[model samples]
Target: MDASLEIRPAAAADAEAVAALLTDFNGEPVDGPTAARRLAALQGIETVLLALRDGAAVGLCSLRVVPFLSADHPYAEVTELYVAPEHRRQGIARRLMREAEALARAQGAPSVYLLTGFQNETAQAFYRSIGYGDYALAMRRRLI
Candidate 1:
Protein backbone atom coordinates (compact mmCIF):
# COMPACT_ATOMS: atom_id res chain seq x y z
CA MET A 1 0.00 0.00 0.00
CA ASP A 2 2.76 2.42 0.86
CA ALA A 3 4.48 1.71 -2.43
CA SER A 4 1.39 2.64 -4.37
CA LEU A 5 0.56 5.73 -2.36
CA GLU A 6 1.36 9.03 -4.06
CA ILE A 7 1.44 12.38 -2.32
CA ARG A 8 1.15 15.68 -4.18
CA PRO A 9 -0.29 19.17 -4.08
CA ALA A 10 -4.09 19.31 -4.30
CA ALA A 11 -6.20 20.75 -7.07
CA ALA A 12 -9.80 21.83 -7.31
CA ALA A 13 -10.59 18.51 -8.89
CA ASP A 14 -9.42 16.83 -5.68
CA ALA A 15 -12.15 18.42 -3.58
CA GLU A 16 -14.09 15.24 -2.95
CA ALA A 17 -10.99 13.24 -2.16
CA VAL A 18 -9.74 15.81 0.28
CA ALA A 19 -13.14 16.21 1.83
CA ALA A 20 -13.53 12.51 2.37
CA LEU A 21 -10.20 12.29 4.15
CA LEU A 22 -11.10 15.18 6.40
CA THR A 23 -14.46 13.69 7.25
CA ASP A 24 -12.94 10.34 8.09
CA PHE A 25 -10.28 11.87 10.28
CA ASN A 26 -12.73 13.99 12.19
CA GLY A 27 -15.40 11.31 12.48
CA GLU A 28 -17.97 13.78 11.19
CA PRO A 29 -19.31 15.19 7.99
CA VAL A 30 -17.29 17.99 6.43
CA ASP A 31 -19.10 19.97 3.80
CA GLY A 32 -17.76 19.06 0.38
CA PRO A 33 -18.78 22.34 -1.15
CA THR A 34 -16.90 24.24 1.52
CA ALA A 35 -13.83 22.14 0.93
CA ALA A 36 -14.05 22.86 -2.76
CA ARG A 37 -14.32 26.56 -2.13
CA ARG A 38 -11.32 26.53 0.15
CA LEU A 39 -9.31 24.49 -2.31
CA ALA A 40 -10.07 27.01 -5.00
CA ALA A 41 -8.82 29.76 -2.74
CA LEU A 42 -5.52 27.96 -2.22
CA GLN A 43 -4.77 28.11 -5.94
CA GLY A 44 -1.58 30.03 -5.27
CA ILE A 45 -0.83 31.48 -1.86
CA GLU A 46 -1.33 28.33 0.22
CA THR A 47 -0.86 24.63 -0.34
CA VAL A 48 -3.08 21.64 0.42
CA LEU A 49 -1.60 18.28 -0.37
CA LEU A 50 -3.27 14.91 -0.63
CA ALA A 51 -2.07 11.36 -0.42
CA LEU A 52 -3.63 8.84 -2.77
CA ARG A 53 -3.41 5.12 -2.71
CA ASP A 54 -5.04 3.01 -5.44
CA GLY A 55 -6.50 6.25 -6.65
CA ALA A 56 -8.31 6.93 -3.36
CA ALA A 57 -7.48 9.67 -0.95
CA VAL A 58 -5.79 8.37 2.17
CA GLY A 59 -4.46 11.48 3.85
CA LEU A 60 -4.06 15.25 3.60
CA CYS A 61 -2.19 18.19 5.12
CA SER A 62 -2.83 21.91 4.78
CA LEU A 63 -0.04 24.47 4.91
CA ARG A 64 0.21 28.24 4.64
CA VAL A 65 3.09 30.67 4.62
CA VAL A 66 2.98 33.53 7.10
CA PRO A 67 5.17 36.14 8.78
CA PHE A 68 7.29 34.67 11.52
CA LEU A 69 8.46 36.11 14.84
CA SER A 70 11.08 38.24 13.11
CA ALA A 71 11.37 40.04 9.80
CA ASP A 72 13.98 37.59 8.61
CA HIS A 73 12.11 34.46 9.62
CA PRO A 74 8.94 33.90 7.67
CA TYR A 75 7.49 30.44 8.32
CA ALA A 76 4.77 28.01 7.38
CA GLU A 77 1.92 26.88 9.57
CA VAL A 78 0.43 23.41 9.21
CA THR A 79 -3.19 24.19 9.81
CA GLU A 80 -4.49 20.66 9.45
CA LEU A 81 -3.23 17.12 9.07
CA TYR A 82 -5.11 13.84 8.80
CA VAL A 83 -4.58 10.27 7.70
CA ALA A 84 -7.31 7.72 7.20
CA PRO A 85 -7.52 5.32 10.14
CA GLU A 86 -6.58 2.34 7.98
CA HIS A 87 -3.46 4.15 6.87
CA ARG A 88 -2.19 5.36 10.21
CA ARG A 89 1.36 4.59 11.48
CA GLN A 90 2.62 4.12 7.96
CA GLY A 91 4.55 7.43 7.77
CA ILE A 92 2.03 9.20 5.52
CA ALA A 93 1.72 12.11 7.93
CA ARG A 94 5.47 12.36 8.23
CA ARG A 95 5.81 12.43 4.47
CA LEU A 96 3.17 15.10 4.17
CA MET A 97 4.95 17.17 6.82
CA ARG A 98 8.30 16.72 5.09
CA GLU A 99 6.86 17.81 1.77
CA ALA A 100 5.36 20.88 3.39
CA GLU A 101 8.66 21.71 5.09
CA ALA A 102 10.57 21.32 1.84
CA LEU A 103 8.24 23.70 0.03
CA ALA A 104 8.31 26.17 2.93
CA ARG A 105 12.11 26.19 2.98
CA ALA A 106 12.19 26.75 -0.75
CA GLN A 107 9.90 29.71 -0.25
CA GLY A 108 12.26 31.09 2.46
CA ALA A 109 10.31 29.96 5.50
CA PRO A 110 12.58 29.05 8.42
CA SER A 111 10.05 26.95 10.34
CA VAL A 112 6.60 25.40 10.52
CA TYR A 113 4.09 25.76 13.32
CA LEU A 114 1.22 23.50 14.30
CA LEU A 115 -1.45 23.54 16.97
CA THR A 116 -2.82 20.42 18.62
CA GLY A 117 -5.49 20.33 21.29
CA PHE A 118 -4.75 19.15 24.83
CA GLN A 119 -5.82 15.53 24.37
CA ASN A 120 -3.90 14.87 21.20
CA GLU A 121 -0.82 13.43 22.83
CA THR A 122 0.10 11.26 19.87
CA ALA A 123 0.12 14.27 17.60
CA GLN A 124 2.23 16.20 20.11
CA ALA A 125 4.76 13.41 20.19
CA PHE A 126 4.86 13.30 16.42
CA TYR A 127 5.49 17.03 16.28
CA ARG A 128 8.22 16.73 18.88
CA SER A 129 9.90 13.93 16.96
CA ILE A 130 9.89 16.19 13.92
CA GLY A 131 11.61 18.97 15.93
CA TYR A 132 8.57 21.07 16.78
CA GLY A 133 8.20 22.56 20.25
CA ASP A 134 5.67 24.44 22.32
CA TYR A 135 6.08 28.20 21.88
CA ALA A 136 2.87 30.11 21.79
CA LEU A 137 0.76 31.37 24.69
CA ALA A 138 -2.79 31.06 23.43
CA MET A 139 -5.47 33.41 24.70
CA ARG A 140 -9.03 33.89 23.71
CA ARG A 141 -12.02 36.15 24.23
CA ARG A 142 -15.55 34.84 24.17
CA LEU A 143 -17.68 36.38 21.49
CA ILE A 144 -20.99 35.29 22.90
Candidate 2:
Protein backbone atom coordinates (compact mmCIF):
# COMPACT_ATOMS: atom_id res chain seq x y z
CA MET A 1 0.00 0.00 0.00
CA ASP A 2 1.18 3.48 -0.75
CA ALA A 3 1.98 5.47 2.37
CA SER A 4 -0.23 8.28 1.13
CA LEU A 5 -3.11 6.09 0.06
CA GLU A 6 -6.24 5.94 2.16
CA ILE A 7 -9.21 3.67 1.82
CA ARG A 8 -12.32 4.76 3.70
CA PRO A 9 -16.07 4.70 3.54
CA ALA A 10 -17.55 7.70 1.76
CA ALA A 11 -19.96 10.20 3.28
CA ALA A 12 -22.27 12.93 1.99
CA ALA A 13 -19.35 15.36 1.97
CA ASP A 14 -17.63 13.15 -0.58
CA ALA A 15 -20.38 13.17 -3.16
CA GLU A 16 -18.68 15.59 -5.53
CA ALA A 17 -15.39 13.76 -5.54
CA VAL A 18 -17.13 10.45 -5.95
CA ALA A 19 -19.24 11.86 -8.72
CA ALA A 20 -16.15 13.16 -10.47
CA LEU A 21 -14.49 9.78 -10.20
CA LEU A 22 -17.61 8.07 -11.51
CA THR A 23 -17.73 10.43 -14.44
CA ASP A 24 -14.13 9.62 -15.33
CA PHE A 25 -14.83 5.92 -15.03
CA ASN A 26 -18.09 5.91 -16.95
CA GLY A 27 -17.31 8.58 -19.54
CA GLU A 28 -20.64 10.18 -18.71
CA PRO A 29 -21.46 13.22 -16.65
CA VAL A 30 -23.02 12.65 -13.24
CA ASP A 31 -24.87 15.51 -11.56
CA GLY A 32 -23.28 16.38 -8.24
CA PRO A 33 -26.53 17.42 -6.53
CA THR A 34 -28.29 14.23 -7.58
CA ALA A 35 -25.34 12.10 -6.62
CA ALA A 36 -25.18 13.81 -3.25
CA ARG A 37 -28.85 13.20 -2.62
CA ARG A 38 -28.59 9.59 -3.70
CA LEU A 39 -25.53 8.99 -1.56
CA ALA A 40 -27.35 10.45 1.43
CA ALA A 41 -30.41 8.36 0.72
CA LEU A 42 -28.34 5.21 0.42
CA GLN A 43 -26.62 5.77 3.71
CA GLY A 44 -26.68 2.74 5.99
CA ILE A 45 -28.02 0.68 3.08
CA GLU A 46 -24.85 0.85 1.03
CA THR A 47 -21.12 1.16 1.42
CA VAL A 48 -19.16 3.31 -0.98
CA LEU A 49 -15.48 2.80 -0.41
CA LEU A 50 -13.37 5.61 -1.70
CA ALA A 51 -9.65 5.42 -2.38
CA LEU A 52 -7.75 8.64 -1.95
CA ARG A 53 -4.11 9.30 -2.65
CA ASP A 54 -2.64 12.43 -1.18
CA GLY A 55 -6.19 13.54 -0.47
CA ALA A 56 -7.31 13.28 -4.11
CA ALA A 57 -9.94 10.79 -5.19
CA VAL A 58 -8.28 8.03 -7.20
CA GLY A 59 -10.77 5.16 -7.15
CA LEU A 60 -13.91 3.73 -5.55
CA CYS A 61 -15.81 0.53 -4.85
CA SER A 62 -19.51 0.36 -4.04
CA LEU A 63 -20.88 -2.61 -2.14
CA ARG A 64 -23.96 -3.77 -0.30
CA VAL A 65 -24.59 -6.60 2.13
CA VAL A 66 -27.86 -8.43 1.72
CA PRO A 67 -29.55 -11.08 3.83
CA PHE A 68 -31.45 -14.03 2.49
CA LEU A 69 -33.26 -16.69 4.52
CA SER A 70 -31.78 -19.47 2.43
CA ALA A 71 -28.26 -18.68 3.53
CA ASP A 72 -26.50 -19.00 6.84
CA HIS A 73 -24.88 -15.58 6.43
CA PRO A 74 -25.41 -12.50 4.38
CA TYR A 75 -23.72 -11.99 1.00
CA ALA A 76 -21.96 -8.85 -0.19
CA GLU A 77 -22.44 -7.41 -3.63
CA VAL A 78 -19.87 -5.02 -5.10
CA THR A 79 -21.71 -3.05 -7.69
CA GLU A 80 -18.86 -0.95 -9.03
CA LEU A 81 -15.10 -0.73 -8.83
CA TYR A 82 -13.07 1.79 -10.72
CA VAL A 83 -9.65 3.41 -10.74
CA ALA A 84 -8.70 6.40 -12.77
CA PRO A 85 -6.81 5.58 -15.95
CA GLU A 86 -3.67 7.15 -14.57
CA HIS A 87 -4.09 5.32 -11.31
CA ARG A 88 -4.57 1.83 -12.67
CA ARG A 89 -2.18 -1.06 -11.88
CA GLN A 90 -1.02 0.65 -8.71
CA GLY A 91 -2.92 -1.88 -6.55
CA ILE A 92 -5.58 0.67 -5.69
CA ALA A 93 -8.35 -1.63 -6.92
CA ARG A 94 -6.87 -4.53 -4.97
CA ARG A 95 -6.77 -2.44 -1.85
CA LEU A 96 -10.37 -1.47 -2.44
CA MET A 97 -11.33 -5.15 -2.77
CA ARG A 98 -9.53 -6.02 0.44
CA GLU A 99 -11.46 -3.31 2.26
CA ALA A 100 -14.69 -4.53 0.71
CA GLU A 101 -14.00 -8.03 1.97
CA ALA A 102 -13.22 -6.61 5.34
CA LEU A 103 -16.55 -4.86 5.32
CA ALA A 104 -18.21 -8.15 4.41
CA ARG A 105 -16.47 -9.91 7.25
CA ALA A 106 -17.56 -7.21 9.66
CA GLN A 107 -21.10 -7.50 8.39
CA GLY A 108 -21.27 -11.29 8.84
CA ALA A 109 -21.08 -11.95 5.15
CA PRO A 110 -19.30 -15.07 3.92
CA SER A 111 -18.86 -14.03 0.32
CA VAL A 112 -18.61 -11.04 -1.97
CA TYR A 113 -20.06 -11.00 -5.46
CA LEU A 114 -19.90 -8.64 -8.42
CA LEU A 115 -20.80 -8.49 -12.10
CA THR A 116 -18.63 -7.37 -15.00
CA GLY A 117 -19.41 -7.25 -18.67
CA PHE A 118 -18.84 -10.58 -20.35
CA GLN A 119 -16.67 -8.99 -22.98
CA ASN A 120 -14.47 -7.13 -20.56
CA GLU A 121 -11.45 -9.39 -20.75
CA THR A 122 -9.21 -7.11 -18.74
CA ALA A 123 -11.58 -6.98 -15.81
CA GLN A 124 -12.14 -10.73 -16.02
CA ALA A 125 -8.43 -11.35 -15.86
CA PHE A 126 -8.04 -8.97 -12.96
CA TYR A 127 -10.80 -10.69 -10.99
CA ARG A 128 -9.33 -14.08 -11.74
CA SER A 129 -5.96 -12.91 -10.50
CA ILE A 130 -7.63 -11.92 -7.24
CA GLY A 131 -9.10 -15.43 -6.59
CA TYR A 132 -12.52 -14.79 -8.03
CA GLY A 133 -14.09 -17.26 -10.46
CA ASP A 134 -16.77 -17.14 -13.08
CA TYR A 135 -19.48 -19.12 -11.38
CA ALA A 136 -22.67 -17.91 -13.01
CA LEU A 137 -23.91 -15.65 -15.75
CA ALA A 138 -25.78 -12.51 -14.86
CA MET A 139 -28.97 -11.82 -16.76
CA ARG A 140 -31.02 -8.69 -16.44
CA ARG A 141 -34.54 -7.77 -17.51
CA ARG A 142 -35.40 -4.15 -17.79
CA LEU A 143 -38.92 -3.35 -16.66
CA ILE A 144 -38.99 0.15 -17.93
Candidate 3:
Protein backbone atom coordinates (compact mmCIF):
# COMPACT_ATOMS: atom_id res chain seq x y z
CA MET A 1 0.00 0.00 0.00
CA ASP A 2 1.26 3.45 -0.86
CA ALA A 3 1.50 5.77 2.11
CA SER A 4 0.28 8.65 -0.01
CA LEU A 5 -2.82 6.88 -1.22
CA GLU A 6 -6.07 8.55 -0.28
CA ILE A 7 -9.61 7.37 -0.78
CA ARG A 8 -12.44 9.74 -0.15
CA PRO A 9 -15.85 10.86 -1.29
CA ALA A 10 -16.01 12.34 -4.77
CA ALA A 11 -16.82 15.98 -5.25
CA ALA A 12 -18.10 17.60 -8.40
CA ALA A 13 -14.60 18.86 -9.01
CA ASP A 14 -13.27 15.32 -8.95
CA ALA A 15 -15.76 14.16 -11.58
CA GLU A 16 -13.31 14.24 -14.43
CA ALA A 17 -10.88 11.97 -12.69
CA VAL A 18 -13.63 9.73 -11.44
CA ALA A 19 -15.12 9.60 -14.89
CA ALA A 20 -11.80 8.69 -16.42
CA LEU A 21 -11.47 5.80 -14.00
CA LEU A 22 -15.01 4.61 -14.73
CA THR A 23 -14.43 4.85 -18.46
CA ASP A 24 -11.27 2.86 -18.17
CA PHE A 25 -13.06 0.23 -16.13
CA ASN A 26 -15.67 -0.39 -18.78
CA GLY A 27 -13.63 0.52 -21.81
CA GLU A 28 -16.22 3.19 -22.52
CA PRO A 29 -15.56 6.89 -22.82
CA VAL A 30 -17.03 9.11 -20.12
CA ASP A 31 -17.81 12.73 -20.89
CA GLY A 32 -16.25 15.08 -18.38
CA PRO A 33 -18.72 17.95 -18.27
CA THR A 34 -21.70 15.67 -18.34
CA ALA A 35 -20.31 13.49 -15.59
CA ALA A 36 -19.55 16.50 -13.48
CA ARG A 37 -23.09 17.71 -13.90
CA ARG A 38 -24.43 14.33 -12.99
CA LEU A 39 -22.26 14.19 -9.91
CA ALA A 40 -23.69 17.49 -8.80
CA ALA A 41 -27.20 16.41 -9.56
CA LEU A 42 -26.84 13.11 -7.77
CA GLN A 43 -25.18 14.57 -4.73
CA GLY A 44 -27.27 13.04 -1.96
CA ILE A 45 -28.69 10.21 -4.01
CA GLU A 46 -25.38 8.50 -4.63
CA THR A 47 -21.91 8.08 -3.22
CA VAL A 48 -18.80 7.93 -5.37
CA LEU A 49 -15.43 7.25 -3.78
CA LEU A 50 -12.24 8.27 -5.49
CA ALA A 51 -8.81 6.77 -4.85
CA LEU A 52 -5.78 8.93 -5.33
CA ARG A 53 -2.12 8.08 -5.16
CA ASP A 54 0.48 10.85 -5.04
CA GLY A 55 -2.33 13.21 -6.05
CA ALA A 56 -3.26 11.29 -9.17
CA ALA A 57 -6.61 9.56 -9.43
CA VAL A 58 -6.11 5.86 -9.98
CA GLY A 59 -9.35 4.08 -9.13
CA LEU A 60 -12.95 4.61 -8.06
CA CYS A 61 -15.92 2.96 -6.42
CA SER A 62 -19.55 4.00 -6.45
CA LEU A 63 -22.37 2.73 -4.31
CA ARG A 64 -25.83 3.67 -3.19
CA VAL A 65 -27.42 3.40 0.22
CA VAL A 66 -31.02 2.87 -0.63
CA PRO A 67 -34.19 3.00 1.34
CA PHE A 68 -36.88 0.55 0.54
CA LEU A 69 -40.62 1.14 0.41
CA SER A 70 -41.61 -1.88 2.42
CA ALA A 71 -40.48 -3.82 5.48
CA ASP A 72 -36.74 -4.09 5.12
CA HIS A 73 -33.88 -2.05 6.41
CA PRO A 74 -31.89 0.18 4.06
CA TYR A 75 -29.19 -1.60 2.10
CA ALA A 76 -26.15 -0.75 0.02
CA GLU A 77 -25.14 -1.76 -3.44
CA VAL A 78 -21.63 -1.27 -4.75
CA THR A 79 -22.44 -0.20 -8.28
CA GLU A 80 -18.93 0.03 -9.57
CA LEU A 81 -15.39 -0.73 -8.51
CA TYR A 82 -12.39 -0.20 -10.65
CA VAL A 83 -8.66 -0.01 -10.14
CA ALA A 84 -6.44 1.08 -12.96
CA PRO A 85 -4.67 -1.86 -14.55
CA GLU A 86 -1.31 -0.67 -13.31
CA HIS A 87 -2.60 -0.37 -9.76
CA ARG A 88 -4.16 -3.76 -9.34
CA ARG A 89 -3.12 -6.15 -6.55
CA GLN A 90 -1.85 -3.25 -4.46
CA GLY A 91 -4.57 -3.50 -1.78
CA ILE A 92 -6.21 -0.35 -3.15
CA ALA A 93 -9.43 -2.09 -4.09
CA ARG A 94 -9.70 -3.75 -0.71
CA ARG A 95 -9.09 -0.49 1.06
CA LEU A 96 -11.71 1.24 -1.03
CA MET A 97 -14.13 -1.56 -0.14
CA ARG A 98 -13.38 -1.17 3.54
CA GLU A 99 -14.17 2.52 3.38
CA ALA A 100 -17.32 1.86 1.42
CA GLU A 101 -18.50 -0.72 3.95
CA ALA A 102 -17.77 1.68 6.74
CA LEU A 103 -19.84 4.33 5.10
CA ALA A 104 -22.64 1.89 4.59
CA ARG A 105 -22.48 0.88 8.20
CA ALA A 106 -22.54 4.47 9.33
CA GLN A 107 -25.60 5.05 7.19
CA GLY A 108 -27.42 2.21 8.97
CA ALA A 109 -27.25 -0.09 6.04
CA PRO A 110 -27.16 -3.67 7.28
CA SER A 111 -26.16 -5.32 4.05
CA VAL A 112 -24.18 -4.53 0.91
CA TYR A 113 -24.65 -5.99 -2.53
CA LEU A 114 -23.11 -5.86 -5.96
CA LEU A 115 -23.51 -7.53 -9.31
CA THR A 116 -20.64 -8.30 -11.63
CA GLY A 117 -21.02 -9.15 -15.26
CA PHE A 118 -21.55 -12.83 -15.84
CA GLN A 119 -18.44 -13.00 -17.93
CA ASN A 120 -16.29 -10.97 -15.58
CA GLU A 121 -14.93 -13.95 -13.74
CA THR A 122 -12.05 -12.03 -12.30
CA ALA A 123 -14.32 -9.54 -10.64
CA GLN A 124 -16.60 -12.28 -9.41
CA ALA A 125 -13.67 -14.06 -7.92
CA PHE A 126 -12.43 -10.93 -6.28
CA TYR A 127 -15.79 -10.28 -4.67
CA ARG A 128 -15.97 -13.87 -3.58
CA SER A 129 -12.55 -13.53 -2.01
CA ILE A 130 -13.93 -10.60 -0.07
CA GLY A 131 -16.76 -12.78 1.28
CA TYR A 132 -19.48 -11.61 -1.10
CA GLY A 133 -21.40 -14.46 -2.64
CA ASP A 134 -24.28 -14.93 -5.00
CA TYR A 135 -27.51 -13.82 -3.44
CA ALA A 136 -30.29 -13.38 -5.96
CA LEU A 137 -30.87 -13.21 -9.65
CA ALA A 138 -31.27 -9.76 -11.13
CA MET A 139 -33.23 -9.07 -14.26
CA ARG A 140 -33.63 -5.86 -16.19
CA ARG A 141 -35.69 -4.65 -19.07
CA ARG A 142 -35.50 -1.63 -21.36
CA LEU A 143 -38.68 0.30 -20.93
CA ILE A 144 -38.00 2.35 -23.98
What lDDT would each prediction earn against the true structure? 0.85, 0.91, 0.87
Clashing pairs in 2: none
* lDDT, ranked from best to worst: 2, 3, 1
TM-score of 2: 0.96
In model 1, the Cα lDDT at residue 99 comes to 90
Each candidate structure's count of clashing pairs: 0, 0, 0
**Best by the lDDT measure:** 2
Residue 115 CA displacement from its true place in model 1, Å: 0.6
Query: Can you give the lDDT of residue 138 in candidate 2?
Result: 87
Off by over 4 Å in 3: none
Question: On residues 1-144, what C-alpha lDDT tens digit does candidate 1 reach at each position?
Answer: 368889899988888887787788787887778789988887666899888888888899989986656677677888889998888898999999999999889888877878898788999999899888999966679999
Superposed by TM-score, candidate 1 places the C-alpha of residue 123 at a distance from the truth, in angstroms, of 0.6
Candidate 1, lDDT over the whole model = 0.85
Range of the 10 consecutive residues with the lowest summed lDDT in candidate 3: 66-75
lDDT of 3 by residue, 1-144 (tens): 579999999988897897788788878888888789878877776799989999999888887887888637787889889999999999899998998999998988888899888998999999999889999988999999
- The all-Cα superposition gives candidate 1 an RMSD in Å to the true structure of 2.1
- Per-model TM-score, in order, reads 0.88, 0.96, 0.94
